[model samples]
Target: MTSVPHVPVVVVGGGQAGLSTSYWLKSRGIEHLVFERRTAAHVWETTRWDTFCLVTPNWQCRLPGHPYDGPDPDGFMKKDEIVAYVKGFVAKVAPPIREGVSVERAFRRGDGVFEVKTSEGDVTCDEIVVATGGYSDPIIPRMAERLPEMIVQMHSEQYRRPEALPEGAVLVVGSGQSGAQIAEDLHLAGRKVHLAVGPAPRCARFYRGRDVVTWLADMGYYEMTVDSHPLREGVRDNTNHYVTGRDGGRDIDLRRFAREGMELYGVLDDFRDGELRFRPNLAESLDFADRTYNGINAAIDKHIAQAGVEAPPPSVYEPVWRPDAERTALPLDGSGISAIVWCIGFTPNFRWLDAPVFNGAGRPAHRRGITECRGVSFIGLPWLNTWGSGRFGAVGDDAEHVVSTIAARLEGAAPAIQAAE
Candidate 1:
């Protein structure tokens, strides 16, 4: 029988997080292999819309040693540019990777060695970094099945451009970052848009003088960990504040979209008998979003004042539009809505891990990124170290932490991390 190929370490993703770990591992002269079920930066290349760009500025695109040295550091990278940047990192680190291979399962054997079952073959390793991150599997609500078959339905990931959609009015459900930005994408292309606003908060793109992200980073918001947060892990489920780095960056104001003739509704409640129903909360949801937007500005203002930094005068957002009345229901049979875009976020799927590190909901349970399971851990998850863990900005830090934990184990000096339960 042919023996399975083995390595000291195996990283199970090819995205920035996994490659970041690979970079550190290589620096330490640790032999490892990366298994990417698809090509490098697969989601950024295949799933992103044509006009998709990073909501965060390019300066935060730090991948271990290879930070963003692009000409447009403050600018958001478009889809193609983003893909190139990731591929560039892959080239620089030159991680030992098999692009088409998939890690189908991972578990620790009784011997303390790890077994990684992959699509192509199996491998044994002393340690494995589950860097696949939290997001997997595009989610479409079951309510979509009730909609008329003729109306085109696609997840936000599948949406490329407005013109590509069916020629008629479009209804975008769930006003999170993706939902709001996609609505803007369609609205800019002159498509009549109806947006279903959720409870997702909104934030300003630029504050007093500089980008709000810059202010937050300067104020140490990125370093705040889950344990330090008042809400603790509850903050993990909170939808991201919707803003845009498109066209030099700006706030994604759904109310402003409504003022500009796009129709806005409250959270979608149900679809019954060819009619879509919405809760009577459009006004409330919009108000909450604006409050969060201005709230962030207020925090930034306080930071500026305390730090004695010169900046433009503080300002608050005033509502530009309000719903005349709560829109309760709309019949789709004759409603000009020809396309429905589901912008609801993805559901977490980590079933392949088959490890004791997961919680009841199947989410990986860890202190920072270190799990109690010997020689097994996770990285690149939201709140893995801080709010920035799930994004390009703080992934480097998380990767470094996970790699350090792994190194400590290799040296038989794993300390506080190994004791995490």
Candidate 2:
């Protein structure tokens, strides 16, 4: 009925990954259009919690060549600082991002280009980079909705602090980093905190005196190849720990949360009236839930041994590190917990992307975020490059690869496009 507008390239999302991809594309003189649903600052600002900070040290904050190796290299950046950093990055490297444009759909035209439908307008492009992020959609479980409305609930994204929650014993569901942190925060704020330990693998921010992430980086854990190693499977299985804000330096780790008086439970059995109920067999189930965690710790120990680093006594963290507790579940009726924090995590939203590039997992099928679907690509996904693809420090490598891939696809037309546009 109407004519669809056209652009040479369309980049969806304005987050770190999308902005990084756009920066690379611009470097090669490729003209592109980026569709951001909100203002540039709001994207990161909206995701921030009251006590949010980056887990990676400043030195590793480099976006490719732009290293965050300032004088305070070892320190972590706060959420606001991160937002400023991203803002500065975009201002200097990639200016004039199309803001407030929401992408509604994108389908392969089956020609050599794509048709991207957005809240602003439809634009056809030869290539599309879906950098919307893996955390675009929160994965709230089906059981959650059925819970009594009187219990009060909210997801991690919507939570600012404990002061905002109801004045009752808080039931922090999902034992990943966020749940643990929130539970700890609520407990410290003087509310009874009960953390639901799901199938999440637990890990301390630091094992000995060294940061686990730093140690992993040094061991080239991020450099593992998804092609040959089965580590992708390993990573996928144990990726829950990093989901929450609990790396020691950034915030109090989970063990400290538990030590500080948060009641830890195995799983939620049901909820009734104002009293939230949980499974009774906590200790045994906790052991079962911690197998993957212990496995990872063991793997790290093996790595340390191989590197000839002095291994700490195994007794310090026997079996699983958290101390034994006589009672597990804590009731949450009086602690104004009218809201629930669903720090549960996110799933890739590719529904708008009608391209046939997705794998069975509904994720875009790609060898390192470069998809086979003509003109369709992905970036900013977990472990896309090394172990840091989703992190700022590692995005540069994938960005470079994606830029190169797009360059080859464009052949020699890059210069002409830049000159014309």
Candidate 3:
């Protein structure tokens, strides 16, 4: 039998979250190893489309000890630029990351240490950090399986460009940021596009003279904790915004797309016998999105007035709508819709972990980054403690917190081990 090498910590996944944790662990003088199934920052390098850009601004790319201090902080980073940025950070920090090493299994041993079985070998660690990020597996609805085989179906992750898709009208399911952006991409490429609008909050790229994100940061919105937030449950489970980073950031809502000659449909309900069905609440969903946008602007305006701060003139966006056919159901045969792209977001994957640290939904069950399982921690989960916990700008803070907890636990265990010896 091969003797398992022991380390103080083992961090799985080498994306932003794992790298951040590695940095903190090194700073605290903790002996650790980081295992990445692919190259470091693999998702940003391969998963994103060619024209994809960071939805958040460049300034929010805050990793531990490496903040974005470039000339265009407000500008969004493209896919290549983002990959380069992560690479630069990794070079600077030089985390002990074993790339292309897949972690097959990770479970606690009888001796209380974690045995992480990997392609290389098994590693025993006192603690384990799962920083695989929130977006794990692409979530496609069951209705997708019912779609006709003739329709070229794909998840947003597999979509590379508009020209690459089958030549016909494209039906994009789920009107979150990816759905809205992909619909717009196809429309610009001269393809007839139909967007299934979901209820997602919309916000103008710029409010007053500052970026919407900047205003939110100024208002301490990002600092709001789950316990103290007014709409804690909603904020925790809210979908992505109907906005895009292309062309210097802009709002991409159902109304805007409708005015731009894209057919808007309500939530996708079912598909049967080559006919797709949708709910008959397209207008109501658009109205709800608008109200949410307006309420956010109203709150920003109120803050400016109460703070007595001089700001730029308010920018008003008039909602535009074009009357179209009531498309509750459409036959896929001759509708010119050749492709269906599902952008319904992602779900976390923890199948490799044989620990009882997951909730009913298979998400890591933890308050902040500390789980019920001792010495097991999770970072890069949405609403782990605050609104920004999973975001690039705020993941470093969560990583630091988890590292501190791990350090304390290790310190306590050292004395006990000495006593046992």
For lDDT, the strongest prediction is: 1
| TM values, all candidates | 0.96, 0.85, 0.94
lDDT per residue (tens digit) for residues 1-421 in model 1: 9998889899988888888889989988889998889987888999999999999999988878888898989999999999998989889999999999988888888888888899998999998888888777888988888777899999998998888888999999999989999999999999999999999999999888799989999998887888888888887888898989999999898878888989999888899977899999999999999889888989998998899999989998999888999998999877799999999989766777867887887678888788888778787888786887887778877787788888887888767754211
Native-structure RMSD, model 1: 1.7
lDDT of 3 by residue, 80-176 (tens): 8899889988997799999999999999989898999999989999899998877888999998888778889999988889989888899999888
Candidate 2 lDDT over 1-421, as tens digits, reads: 9888787778888877777887788788888888888876675688667777766677788775456745667677777777888877777666447888889988876476688888877889888888887777777767676766787777787778788777766677776666666666677678877677666556555665566677777777667756545764345435456423333364334445666666676667565554566666556645644555556566777788788888574413444245465343444544545566766677778788777787676656677777656577788887664667787877877877777777777674332111100
Ranking by TM-score: 1, 3, 2
On TM-score, the candidate that comes out on top is: 1
Higher-TM-score candidate among 2 and 3?
3
Q: After superposition, how far is residue 265 of candidate 3 from its true place, in Å?
A: 0.5
Question: Against the hidden true structure, what lDDT does model 2 obtain?
Answer: 0.68
